[model samples]
Target: MEYFKKILRFAKPYRVYALLNILSNIFYALFATLAMISLFPMLAVLFKQTEPVFEKPIWNGISMGKEYLMEYLNYFVTQKSESGSPGDTLFFMVAIVITAFFLKNLFGYLAMYFITFLRNGVLKDLRNELYVKTVELPISYYSEKRKGDTIARITSDVLEIQHSFLSILELVVREPLTILFTIIAMLSISAKLTLFVFLFLPISGFLISLIGKSLKRKSDKVQKEQGYFLSILEETLGGLRVIKAFNAESRFSNTFKKSTKRFYNFSNSLLNRQNLASPTSEFFGIAAIGVILWYGGQMVLVEKTLKPELFITYMGLAYQILTPAKAISKASYGVKKGNAAAERVLEILETENPIAEIPNPIEKNTFESGIALEDISFKYGEEYVLKNFNLNVPKGGTVALVGQSGSGKSTIANLVTRFYDVNEGTIKIDDVDIKNLKKESLRGLMGLVTQDSILFNDSVKNNIGLGKKDATLEEIIEAAKIANAHDFITALPEGYDTNIGDSGNKLSGGQKQRLSIARAVLKNPPIMILDEATSALDTESERLVQDALEKMMRNRTSIVIAHRLSTIQNADTIVVLQKGEIIEQGSHTELISKKGAYQKLVEMQSMG
Candidate 1:
């Protein structure tokens, strides 16, 4: 309910629709009670038990509204009895009852019709807002979360909210109003009987509430287990090749089975609790009906205190209350289940994004001087990955950082692009601190190409144009040519329109790397960060990709993080790092002459 209150604002926009629905429901509830009460007069005519009334129907100096109503009905029946025949009176009463019932259903349908807009509107807005928030959240958020869990939130849990929570508007509002109007009609007929009906209600309600007490907690556990199994299934599908290659099918199957077994037990418990609502509520309502019969029968058979027809109408009204009461019992269970899903969705919508742009940030257009990492330090957690790091790549100069794995080579590239902020010290670009610049303006001046070719399942033209949206077709071709991807693209059946399958799996490793280069080339920013761009390629592919990289880096300020020694041999300055500290810094030839860390790295690579 707390999370539901948070999402109430989304439903505000559709208040007009909800209001119309409520109005329709109000009329429907009123008419439904009238429909039941109308049958009483017809029963009086059929059973020949009509009450003979006095002129003014004034009883004990108080005007009985029921007697006045009965007087009016008797006047109509008496007029028709005099006009043609007794059958005419019966025909008139039947027409009135049938017309009232038809109208009851008509308004009921209209209420549901109007509510459809409100239900689907909330669903659409919830899904859209979830999508927007998912993308706006920082990348660091995903590092600690499973992708499948997020997927379940947006898909399964949201759907549950719609079904359980949003649909409550229909059942909770209309059905309860219907019950209230019917109860009022019953009370007007005989307050004592209405009071008796309510006496049984509280006991039934208490028992129903008891069944739903732990439903939310159980539902939350079940949803979490569902996500766990989904994540395992996602992982199994993604890594089937590894599982098969290592002959670990049984191992993964056992793990998945364990997860699913827990899901099964939890799901069964949740469903078992929910399944209790209908039967228990119906059983209690039936018990109340039995008590109504036992007591009301005495009033008719022995005391002669109540007329048979009015008692029959009273029974109809009492029976009507049972449905909404049962629906309320069911809806209570639904609310409990929806509470869990609502909490999950609100957790995402209410999450504070850690890497958002500052208020009134600087708007730098282009780099003029260079990018500088001045005594910078960073860490993913408590362990420092980059400590006291210092580097300068002047405008139009190429500086390469060559080191073994875990030496913070890629961290330097990440900091340069502000993909992450440094924990200590500052990174300045063009003599301005990066924190001061608008993130968009700062990123507009740079391009990045990671070793994993991050190509989507899109067309070749679209993938390249991502670097510079709205780029012309000719510009795309020119960039592809610069990346040495034009030949392969042109050879494809659809050329630029060829769909690069998932992660460009349709293309070769070299072809994919070339396309990634083409994307960066199309952007043509002043500064570029290539993080092991050719690391995963074979020798031939590396040479081609490296050649394309060299071409792109020409006359551009580039920070290259390379694992291979040969690729950065011609860099203007090559920095060597050890244990998050700069060990050597000079031109490639100068570093080789020093016979230091750089020399030892080159020697080891040559022997390999």
Candidate 2:
């Protein structure tokens, strides 16, 4: 319920729709009760049971209003039967019943109509917030979380909230009001019988509540299994090539089947429990009706304390209570299921981001001096990945980092971009601690191109334009020319308008890398970070991409993480790292002259 209330805040903007739904439901409840009560007058007329009335019934106070209204209705029926035909009196009573029923259904439709806006409005707002949070959260947040689970929260959990929580808007007012109004009508018919009805209600309610006790816990398991299986599906799709190449389809299939079987079991348990709600509540309702029949029979047939017509009407009103009671019972189960999903969704919404920007952070737009990692130490979890590591790249100069795997080259890029903060020491840009700078403004000062060219399923032009939101087509073409991608792009079926497919699979590796370089060139930032950008390409592709990289890095402050040392031989400075510490640093020629780790790595690659 706590999470339920938190989700309800999303509906505040559509309160007018909620208010209108409530208003319509009130009238619907009134008509629903009146429609049932109207049956009594018709029965009275058909059986010729109405008493004679010589004079008009007098106006009475609220307590005796029911008695006065009954007498007045009997008096009118008597007049109609006396003045016209008995058939006319029957027709008039039937018309009253039909009108009550018509109004009931009319307002019922209006109630549903008004609530549609509120339900969909909350859904749209909730999804929009989820998407914004997904993009705003630090990249490290995803390192330990499944992408599919996050997708499930935004998609499935939100739908559950709509099914369960938002639906409360319909059930909360209508069902309770229906039950309340019907109970009042029952009391007006026979207070003694109504009191007897109340005795059985609490017992039935308690029993029904017992069924829902374990529903939330079970529902939580079901939702989590749903995320688990979805994660498997996402992973399988993303790694289909590897699975086929290794001939490990059977392994992944068995794993997926196991998850699905668990999901099937959980879903069965949850839905079976939910299905039990309707029949259980209905059975209790019918049991209560049976008890009423026994007691009310004594009053009407044996004791003569109640009228036959009114006793029949009392039974009708009593049965009317069951519909709303059943509805409320089902809604209770829905709320339980919805509550579990809400908790999962709120977990993400309420998470505190460790990399949050400080208030009044400095907005740095220029790189006047250089980027410096001063005695920085960091770790992903337990052991340090970068321990007291330091490096400097002055403006308009390239500093290349060459190391084997896990040597913290990429960690430097992440820390400098504020993707993750250093556990100890500070990283400063132009001597200003990067922690003091606004993250967006700091990232705005640099361009990044990684080993895998990250392109989206969009047009070639749009992919390049991603570097600058409002980049013109001419700007895109000029940037492409600079990165040597303009010729291939124009040769495509639609040229700049060509769809790149998923992750730009439609283009070759080198073409994709060039587009990435072109995107960076379009941004034209003062600082560029290349993380083994040409390591994955073939010799020809590497040459072309290296040419593009050199063109883009000519006058920019660049930090190049090179897996192939030959690419950085002409760099202004080369730093060789081992494990997590820098072992050699100098110009490329000087490092080779030292006959150290850098020289050995170059010799090893040459032998390969």
Residue 428 in model 1: lDDT:
94
Any residue pairs clashing in model 2, and if so which? none
lDDT of 2 by residue, 163-189 (tens): 998888898999899989999998888
Candidate 1 per-residue C-alpha lDDT over 1-608 given as tens digits, one digit per residue, 9 for 90 to 100: 67767766778889988888888888888888889999998998898765444344444433477777787677666666667787888888899889988988898899889888888888899999999999888666888888788888988999889888887787756888888888878878878877876887788888889999999999999888778878888888878779999999999889889988998998999999999999999999889889888888988889988888998998888888888888878888988999999999999998987667788999988778988889999998889999888888899999999888999998887777777888999999978889888888888999899999999999999999997878999999999999999999999989999998877889999999999999999999999999989889999989889999999999899988988888998899899988788989999889878889898988898833
Indicate the residue-level lDDT of 585 in model 1. 98
Relative to the unseen true structure, what is the C-alpha lDDT of residue 364 in candidate 1, on a scale of 0 to 100?
87
Q: Each prediction's TM-score against the native?
A: 0.96, 0.98
- Per-model clash counts, in order, read 0, 0
Local distance difference test values of all predictions, in order: 0.87, 0.92
Best by lDDT: 2
Off by over 4 Å in 2: none
